[model samples]
Target: MESDLSTSDYLDQIERLPTHEREGQLFWKLRIRETRSQLRHLFANSRLRTSLVISLSIVFWIGLFVLFYLGFDFVVGQVGLPGATYHAQTVQFVFTLFFMSLQIMLIFSSGIILYGGLYASNETNHLLTLPIRDSRIVLYRFQESLFFSSWGFFLLASPMLIAYGIVVSAPWYYYAYLPGLMISFAYIPCTIGAIICLILISRVPHLRRIVVGIIALLIVVVAYTSIWRTLDIKDADLLGAAWFKQTFRRFEFTREEWLPSTWLSNGLLEAAREETFDPGDLPWFESGKYLIVLLSNAMFFHVILLWVGGLLYRSSYYGLNSRQARQTHLRMAWIDRITEKLLWLLPRETQLLIIKDFRMFRRDPVQWSQFLIFFGLLMLYFANIDRFRQHRQDINVLAWVNIVSFLNLAVVGLILSTFTTRFIYPLISLEGRRFWILGRLPIERDAILWGKFLFAASGSWLPCAILVVSSDIMLRVSIQVIVIHQFICLMLCIGLSGMAVGLGAIMPDFREQSPSKIAAGFGGTLNLVLSAIFILLTVLLTALPCHFYFMANESKLQTQMIPAGNLLLWLSLGLIGVVLLTALVTIVPLMGGFRAFRKLEV
Candidate 1:
């Protein structure tokens, strides 16, 4: 370390230097150069990773766009009267719901992300040592938090809006305004989250988490009550006008002019509705009005964020660090005891490793909070799933019930895939810098991979199993279907966990400290793509035989007799195929990861 006198002399010399306004410009200019350098490395050094990620992303995007196009076409051409007012209203209503849901998700996720970055990261400490203003640093980090939280928002939102544009035959201006509108709309929730994060940390350091919990609870209450009311339909009303009315009414609040989602949805729909291709058409004014509203709000929020950050950022940093330094004891919970008891069959080292991973997740609110928000939404929907069911023995209805059950299983599996991708895939990569400690331990390197796999599998299984059971119970499916769903859930947990852990070992990013960045890399993208392919196959195989069985059993007048033996044989074959797929998915990855772990240099 340099002597205090020398450090003081250097600091005094630095203070005497004049600050140029363009120094801030210089920072961003350097940032762009660094980004270009990284992109060049991605293209030049990692061509395979680049190609695979791009191809997979395009496939995913095109698939979603096609689904939206078909749905919109059906609603317009097949549903209700051909030229009816209902078509436009229905499209606008859906747009409102889509943007509104994304708004709530962005705000919640942004808060969690900001907390992890602003308070928890060591990088923030390093940034504070530079000559930059605290507000400037906060703004830089805010952009990161926004991007991290909203990439999924962009991916899901853009396709739907673009598909709607095609269906409506909108003017090119609609597509032109889309990127700007989305950016402005997304900025609102993220700004709100940032403001809340700063105030909570700076003013009430002790009550920050409690405040966050209260906010989350409020959001949950609102979401649950609103959705529950919409879903509280009688079985007799299935596919009837009454069910549609209630559902639409529940989401009607989304159209309130005060809401930013309403602004975006209205802007897109209005612009999409314009038939004229003229560059300066009078019809453009309607959409342009909402666009102006969105932009003005974004600019206003931008000013407020900088002001708030300037006021609170530095103090919040110090106060937060001071508070953490004084806090030491971590009391063990009953959950830990139960976890140990449940894993008694595992070796001591493996058990300890699992326990360590469990604690880390528990300590990180960003991880568990997201888990609860997403899975909790599913849990809510599953509990209320009976609304879509009808007791009538109509063959179509019964067939739909079976189809939906299989779809529910698919949904749960897809979500678990994302969970594993986001959190589990980073496990080995996170350990890269710290492998020396494990190297000195008595445990073999292979145990590290196994421990992560087991933790991912068991931890994901419980909630997913509950979700599947609840969905089946509410749908009133037969016990056989429920058993099948449970089996599929187990298979998904094992396969996804194995894929994430294995690929994580194979292509670990030891140098990148951020988990979000790690998960966004090539390996995580591959794991996600593989998981999706696995789910598609599993659902197709299982749903086909079950659909046939349901159709044969539920029909009032049987046109063709179907043998129980044949149905059983088909179902058995599907399950056998699924089992083999799951085994290959789980085993191949784990074995590969173990081999890689053994040969790892660090």
Candidate 2:
């Protein structure tokens, strides 16, 4: 009997040992192989070699740096009066506040990313089944999340930081310090984001709806406060002016002074100033105090992550996984009934397909929530047009209005491109292994393709049109300009939607389950690059004629080179060219996509 007990104990001990001890090494090796495979595949394509891709990426980044530098130089030249050196401090403070707000945004965005798929990935589930320690898995995921979230911030900040250095003419050491500051600054947000995600996943698995509601309320509150503070218009009398003065003078306390972003900004600004001004009394590295603060805080947060990860990672992961088992049925029967009633005019298949897409979109909290946050913020900004008009009365109101109206077209185009790439581009790819079901259906490939295009175009058009028309109305532009701008926006929407759907179909990644992962692939990159190029060309074509007309009216030399009649003819030709370009961009990709889909054996 004692020997039997010992044998059973030995067996249990063996079972407790890790199933795949070399899994960590295996994971990295697979990653390397996948990267190499992608590179080989990219180079295999005749149109896009590895060298060409690298060259273009480098050129694009350099162009961005140069453009931002020039813009900064122009702004500083305009605003940097000799006696206004005190304004430098104000600039630093404002930038500090901006970075702090961005960090807060990052925290929420990271939590969403974690909840969306990172923690609940297939690999993570597999890992949990092994005998490996849970802390290691948490650590690995945290590292990956940090890298993914921080790299974009680093790329964006690089140009702006370099531009600041050039503007200040800082010394070499200041340039050296800039990268360290950015790195440490990035780490703070990443750590905070991880902690927030961990807490939410562990403590409140069903918190998404509550959090989204809170965010919506906060957005409304912010919009209301901004309008209240800025809309202090009154009668042109003594009481009115006094009321405005008093409102403007009301003091408020803020926590910006203690924020890490403030520390980073102060450190960088001080270092730059010292390099330029030669403040001899201060010791070397005295300006390094804020840098020290940033680094120390980053390190402290990282240590906290390790501690929490070691303690709660296993239990939290179990909680998270268990919560996934409790499925909630969506009460979308009303939606189906309404759709059936409303779409009686259309064919059954088309109506069913549309309804399916709508239900899929509505069911995915991650997808629709992101959509709400992005467009909601835009709507909030648009809602404050009255304040913008009130504050900018010192300028030529008509010209300002016209300029804003023209710029609004570009902004709307960009927003549409983003929406298409994020949502529309992943539609076909997201069908996954179930695509065979679609193939067996009686629906034609062209019908499916056109449905996606039409849906995407119509979905994007309403918001774009509303924002554009509202801005135009606020600007009080002429009826002719409003009609022209609205037409341009419509064309942009159609073209962007077509490009996104076609490119998505051509390079559908059926293997990846996550939409974000699919969108991060090569096809998505190409879609974005093409969309940007198209937007640029469209804007240039439309804006040039407007510029000529505006110049002809504003300047006295208009009659010499071109008469108003000739200018109108030129403008008409330009509009025609724009229409042709938009049509071509919209049609070619869709045709290619249809052919690609038809050729697929599945």
lDDT accuracy of residue 320 in candidate 1 = 77
Off by over 4 Å in 2: 1-37, 44-56, 78-84, 223-255, 275-284, 307-332, 336-347, 391-395, 547-561
Best by lDDT: 1
TM-score of each: 0.91, 0.84
Cα RMSD of all models vs. native, in order, equals 3.9, 4.9
Error of 2 at 530 (Å): 2.2
- What TM-score quantifies how close candidate 2 is to the native fold? 0.84
Give per-residue CA lDDT, model 1, range 167-227, as digits (tens).
8677899998899899999999999988888888899987765665666667667778987
| Candidate 2 lDDT tens digits, 1-602 | 99999999988976776554465676667668977987776778734533543555566567778887886677568557212564354446446655766676667655555554445578777777866655566666766566555655665567777886787566677787887788888788878877776776678766756766577568666745754554555543222555544443431112256777777777776666543255664422745777788899999998887677767777777775667565566665787778667768777777777778877877666666666766666666666665556656644665666677778778778877867887889898876357789888998877777778877876688888988888777766778788888888888999999999988888787766666656655676567667877887887786778756765666544576678778778778878888999989888999889999888664
